[model samples]
Target: MTAHVQQLHRVNNLCAGLEWVADCPNRLARKALLQLIGEEVGFVLEGVICASEQKIPGGRPPA
Candidate 1:
């Protein structure tokens, strides 16, 4: 779990650097940022399900 969070943080930092590159067009940067945001949201949701299943008895986590 710690490793996953660390990887996500690294990805976010890389995305930030890509967003600041002068050669990348505004539209392209926006698209990349949006994709990264989607990935981050998915990660958060997965973490939530994992935590919830551990806390609740007989709770089946989402696939």
Candidate 2:
């Protein structure tokens, strides 16, 4: 999220946004924000985000 959106309809939207940040392409700012989301990632996404540090490829996690 480069810029903030003002109108979020539901609380779940925030949660969904976190999932998007987790699974979507790499963004240093987003990753930084993701760390503040708490420790439920392993239980919630089943390692979808926690399994590795890369999402797109050809970067750090490729090794």
Across residues 1-63, which tens digit of lDDT does each residue of candidate 2 receive?
111122222234556778777775668867776775434433444333333435446535532
- The Cα RMSD in angstroms, rounded to one decimal, for candidate 2 relative to the true structure is 14.8
The prediction achieving the highest lDDT against the true structure is 1
Name the 10 consecutive residues with the lowest summed lDDT in model 1.
15-24
RMSD of 1: 4.7
| Model 2 misplacement above 4 A | 1-9, 33-63
lDDT of 1 at 51: 67
Q: What is the C-alpha lDDT of each candidate?
A: 0.66, 0.49
lDDT of 1 at 37: 62
